[model samples]
Target: MRRKSLSTGDLARYCQVTPATIVNWIRAGKLDVYTTPGGQYRMELPKFIAFLEDNEFPIPEELQADRTRKILIVDDEEEILDLLVEVVEGSDANYIVRSEKNGYDALIAIGDFKPDIVSIDLNMPKMDGAELVRRLRSNPETKNAKILIVTGMIPTSDLVRKVKRIGVDSFMQKPIDIDEYAKALDKLATFKV
Candidate 1:
């Protein structure tokens, strides 16, 4: 378990200084601390962390936050799927990526992966992207996941309106322009960052 507070000894050990020095620093008001009933000095976690950071001290490993993002790609075309996987994985950002050939497999993957972003192709064999988007919007688990609709067909005004009403974040007409797709992913993932 992570410690909620640090003692003089703890700070001294972390700084490679004597316990007396910690007490001196506390007495001089250089470090924020509180006194216990038994006259023990205790530094709360936040203050200690701030002191370390403000002084350019290395933060402990356990205190560092994970910045990884998750992505799920749903498309029936094998070529498109492979290309997307390659592009997303090859990016500089931290992402855990998965690809599914159809919406059914995508749905199953989403249950476990709970991706932050879902890049979906509109037409597939078993279940289309439109139906998958509806399901995602309805589900509590994935309701907030960002959806980027990628389609080969020129959408009618009604189809565009329907998808927008269904809560897609953005759309890209495809022959899959690599640059535009990468830009879309960057924009979608930026919200979380």
Candidate 2:
């Protein structure tokens, strides 16, 4: 899995140039990019890598593999959510995380965050993680985002079937083991498929 797209500043630092120079490259049609609503440019990972290869720039190790990745976590329980955040993002600066208490706001955040992986509780109020997974799968923009169910709910045969059809990438029981969580994230973040 690829990380989020690079900002002009991020790319500039990699290439040892000013952000203005990166923008000039974009303006001159030497590199391709998409602009956010805020008018900032983003260079997609694959395209940026291709650009570097074509131009003979050294691909930074971070861009090449095990780079900083985005993660989004959703749960309704405030205490549990805070604990999960503390555990997930506390020691690891490589993971940038965002959290929401409901599926609705999580959906809204997904539009901008474009998280590489989402760890969500299946029992969230209103839109539940199952439906959230369905909606994410249905969207072309987010269809491939990896979903990990981190919930206290015990898995039933029927429930397993339901989410299997919904296409979840992984699962973790609540009272999550930090090692297991880290391993799951490591597998999904860099896994090719």
| lDDT: worst 10-residue window of model 2 | 59-68
lDDT of 2 by residue, 14-129 (tens): 77999999989999999899999999999888788667755667767667574567789899999978877776676454788899999999999999998878888888888988
Mind sharing the TM-score for model 2? 0.68
Off by over 4 Å in 1: 1-66
Give the clash count for each candidate: 0, 0
TM-scores of the candidates in the order shown:
0.65, 0.68
Off by over 4 Å in 2: 1-62
State the C-alpha lDDT per candidate: 0.84, 0.82
lDDT of 2 at 70: 79
Give me the candidate number with maximum TM-score.
Answer: 2
